[model samples]
Target: MQKIKIKGQDYQLPIYLPDATLGVARNLDSLDLLQVGLEGVMVNTYHLIQKPGEEILQKVGGIKKLMNWSGFVSSDSGGFQLFSLIQKNPELGKITDEGIVLYTGPKKQKKTLFTPEDSIRMQFALGSDVMICLDDFSPPKANEKRIRESVERTIAWAKRAKVEFEKQLQKHGFTDDNRPLLLAPIQGHNSHKWREFCSQELQKIGFDIYGLGGWPLDEQGKFDYSFCQKNAELTPKDSLRFALGVGTPENIVKLFFMGYQFFDCVLPTRDARHQRLYVFKVDPKNLNQEILKKLTEENRLQEIFDYTYIGKGKFATDNSAISQFCDCTLCKKTDDIAQVSKAYLHHLFKIEDGSAFRLASLHNLRTYTLLIEALRRA
Candidate 1:
């Protein structure tokens, strides 16, 4: 699909949504996001419900109003966060067919059940354009039996989520053409048989989009491109696919070719805060399908995408801008004000200045958006 229509608004596909886990994208605000050319953001349902609570969101008329944002927002089912918590501490919670059972409070004795229905209700309250169904996350080291259980539970929860989604649409007076899009993730780890089963079952239940669930990593802990390709094949050619928590620029380019059009990852912002900056080796103004195809065919995508560790001591005296092609606040120079150079950014980081985070984030976000612009043109 070249584009997706949400609530009657048209947005181009192969879009990258930065993670705004708890109603914010770390250092950047909504205006900063728009300034960096981002059209959408992803939020975590579980986190928002716990912090801001549902009542506050309803009072404020949803997250968009609360954040003063006027762009598309996608809410994740929050299954991944819960899964990680429970995995790290078994006493925290447990996943069942009904939903996730949590042990909260000081003694871990307080019982709270987060069901698939609840996830949908929360996303509706948040007024997300795209909402994901809660699914059992497959841990990296999951075995055959664990994989089977995850797939089974994922399908069961998806059925419940779909029911809840329809109820909300009617209650909110949203029609088929203007309703929010629901997405269900397929989970089965790396097992082809189980992955196929998960995909088929989710397809039967139906959703506007299909997500590539579980960790996209191989035994060596490297990105598993073959697995992503297989998952994309599991869905129809025309069906929209979301690469949840998907990755670096190179990964996005490869997955876009494999038919995955939607992406969300914390990499850009997270890396920015850690002093890692992404830059294009060559100007992307000359990008096209032919060039992209040739680069992929020759496995030369790595050449175009480069990185800079800005916190390094070597950059303290470097007067160069982060990226010559970047048009972010830090990179743009005016007659009176000078562009933020590597030397200044390095000094800011060394002094632990808060502006360092915001400036770096702006630059990094712009880099990602520029890549998206190129992909859209191609």
Candidate 2:
């Protein structure tokens, strides 16, 4: 599998699955909907282990064979979920020198322990092309002391994950011909100083890539464009720089200009489910008079397309319009929003329809894939 190099950063472009179970259930066919040139897929380590379990994946000949996906695949350490669990049920998590232990699942039925080493070992079993290290995440608004503590823990975990990965490679007799790469994550909520420090430290450990700028940038507005710009500049040039959990088209455009080479997030697909389509062009010139009037006058257009309240009455259409314009197969074959109407999508939100969720998800995934192609050209 060839690694991608952009502006000196090396990465295997990832097609991310926000949830492993959903990804597996959707199966390999869903990948056909990706834009023509997508490079890889990403799955969650936590969700896979909880639902299908690592053993099932291994028996099915690893993630690649199970999904029948030929391209590269990467798995995230369950660190983010651990953070979420701590917030929701503080009593369910225990932080130790080894790692954090958590009680997971419905009815809190199962107990799973996730140490840095454990994260690496599970990823090894799943046979991902690249695996991320477990890192501590601090909220963007966290006090300086807490941020520092989280940064230190993240560094510690990076070192541990590296040591464990190296040992695994040696045991498996993995030469450069066949060795899985590990991606070290940079932590430090909104503090530029801490972010730089974390990057510098992780560079010394020497992982294949870096997962830059975690959930903080999303949760809080503290780290702006300049923060991402500086962090991308400071990161090692040879390793991949992936801005995790950032997929907004506008944000991606800004980050691409800042030298970021890779990214993964659920926003595109998640937002698509809500009937929000992302079009690159600036606000349509005749939005109010022409588009709105057409929509109001025609029953179908009014039924399918309408002015968006979110973007100051910008013309918004269901997945069908955006999909039809897109080159992806989902749009080409289905021809009209995969048999679901815009009104149905809107109703899905009002009544919560699972079918609408699937349709919207497919559209969003295609939209993101298309956006990446556009960025690559630029």
Backbone clashes counted, model 2 = 1
Clashing pairs in 1: none
Off by over 4 Å in 2: 1-22, 25-37, 104-112, 216-223, 282-320, 329-355
- What C-alpha lDDT does candidate 1 achieve relative to the native structure? 0.93
Reference-based TM-score, model 1: 0.98
RMSD of 1: 1.2
lDDT of 1 by residue, 1-378 (tens): 387789999999889999999999998899999999999999999999998999999999999999999999999999999999999999999988889999999999999999999999999999999999999998889999999999999999999999999999999999989999999999999999999999999999889999999999999999999999999999999999999999999998899889999999999999999999999898876775568768987999998999999989899898778888778888887763439999999999999999999999999889988888888885
Candidate 2 lDDT (Cα, whole model)?
0.64
| Backbone clash numbers for all candidates listed | 0, 1
